[model samples]
Target: MFGFLKRKIKEFITGTKKEIEKETKEEKGPGERAIERAEKEIREKTKKEEKEKVEEKPKEKSEKKEAIEEFEEKGKKEKLEEKEEKEAEEKRDGLFTRFKKIFVSKKLGEDDFNNFFDKLELILIENNVALEAIDALRENLRKELVGKEIKRKELEKEIENALKNAISSLLIDSFDLIEKIKTELKEKKPYVIVFFGINGSGKTTTIAKIAYMLKTHNITSVLAAADTFRAASIEQLEKHGKNLGIEVIKQKYGADPAAVAFDAIAHAKAKAIDTVLIDTAGRMHTKTDLLREMEKICRVAKPSLKIFVGEAITGNDAVEQAKAFNETVGIDAIILTKADVDEKGGATISVSHVTKKPILFLGVGQEYGDLKRFNKKEILEKIFD
Candidate 1:
């Protein structure tokens, strides 16, 4: 899964590690070199002063004069040695103090990660990640990677771990559909769940898959074909109902969609159904009239859960659609379709982060059994491996 994105990210990490290692080997840091030069100068000056003192000794003198001169010379030498020792200590302190300043800052320098992150941003854009999501990831990576010195041999592994953690933080939100439905059923005999998405996002198929999944757990559900705007939509849903042996409640095209949903809820209530899965028309989020109509459906149905269906292969478009639907009707969760075909897989990562919603499932293939529950650990492993 996500083979293209995975390969790109891995290659970038490896290439960056090699570049940093090469730079570290070819050139030493300025701070270390400055300290080395200061120590060399101090040693040379000390040796020259000692040699000059030795050459200045007198050959002969009277005993008393020699003794007095010797005492005076001893005092002058002691004072001179003290002054030199203090100056040397100050020079040493000044050199190493400047060196310590280089290592104590809380953020990495531009030289540490600027080039690497610039390339990463470009790669994410090429892979169709949303600009907002890309910015969020960049900020997160900076926080995780900065303030730490790079270790040569361990640099790759450290970067990989940080990236994994950053992605997981954005995508991981725990949700269990079956358990949630079971709990909802306790309060109301028929729990209504409405699904909406843009046209051709595989919304109908996802509804059918959800119905099939419910049946396996011995829970009964009714499908509400409330998508009255599209004539084929109602028929498509009816076909899915027939295949699954579940009842579909629908009305004629051009009829009010909110009425269809109300009727479905009434039927579910009358029949004591365990759940009601309502499929809305695949209208573009940009259409204000259609969006208002969707809002009417939500107001009338008052569903326990509102889910948005999105196509993973659609990339940033999917993220935008999800955001619009969420703003209009307030989606509680998401289900991404065509994940198996999405080599870039940017929508899956971007949508959840942008919407602050959990992804409940992934549509991997055509069969009903192809729906897979979203797992953050498995996803990170696939991307980083």
Candidate 2:
């Protein structure tokens, strides 16, 4: 997972380190050069004065003046040496202190960070990261890295830490779906959850996975074929229900999807079911119509939780979809499908932050056991560790 993004980040870090090191090595300190020039001029002036005095002044007076000149020059040299020694001693306190003076001067300046972040921004954009997320990442990294002291050999690790911290901050925390259901079941008979997403996004499969997951936890659930718009949408859900040994409450095609959801909720109440998983159609091309229909379902079913399911490989598209859904019906959580095949994994990073919702699960494969809970630490490890 995140294979493409991982490789790109590695390349970016290496490239940034090279640029910084090259600039540091090539940089010229005008202060040292000016000091050397001034000292040389002073020495030459003293020597010329001594020569003139030796030629024109009395011998004893010339010698006395020469001795005084030599003593003053020695004092000046000693002062310069003492200043350099003290500065060196201060810098030599620790390896980090020494490298701080060596690597990019005192600290990473805004200009240096901006130059390197431009490369990181391009990598993120190419990998389908959303603009808002990229902006947040830039700010977070700038806060952590810009004006910060770092060692030369640890540059890559420093960048990784900042990137990881920024990415972690972007993702909202996920809640355990099972634990939530168990808690809600104490107050209600069935916890109703409606799944929303565009067509061909594996919404039906994800519902089945959720139901299977609930079953394994000894939480009985019934599938609601609320997607009556498509021709075979009901059958698709019924097939999953059959396979999982769960019941499907459905109506004929062209039926009101909201009515289907209401019936499923009623069924769960009648049969003492633990949860109700409602499936909806993906008529995203007509977003207005889709939202109106989803709103009706929400009104009729009064679902406890609304989940926006999306394809992980869709990247920014998934984020936009989740944003639209949340704006319309306010999604409670998210589930990203086909995550196992996602190389860039931009959606995994962008969706939650875009919608301000936690991602509950990642559908990793086709099997019932393929549903993996979303974990922030695991994501960081996979990308960087």
Each prediction's total of clashing residue pairs, residues at least 3 apart in sequence or on different chains, is: 0, 0
TM-scores for candidates 1 onward, in order: 0.80, 0.82
Q: Evaluate all candidate structures by whole-model CA lDDT and list the values in order.
A: 0.85, 0.86
Off by over 4 Å in 1: 29-108
Candidate 2 lDDT for residue 313: 94
Can you write out model 1's per-residue Cα lDDT over 167-191, one digit (the tens) per residue? 8878958599999999878887788
Model 2, residue 244: what's the lDDT?
Answer: 91
> What digit string (tens of lDDT, one per residue) describes model 2 on residues 1-385?
8999999988888888887767655653564455446555655565565456444534444355677786785577567656755554454345334433453443688998898889899999998899999999999999999888776677778888999999999999899888888999999888999999999898999999999988889999999999988888898889999999999999989899999999999999999999999999988877789889999999999999999999999999999999999998899999999999999989999888888899999999999899999999999898886
Error of 1 at 83 (Å): 46
Give the lowest summed-lDDT range of ten residues in model 2.
Answer: 91-100
Off by over 4 Å in 2: 28-106
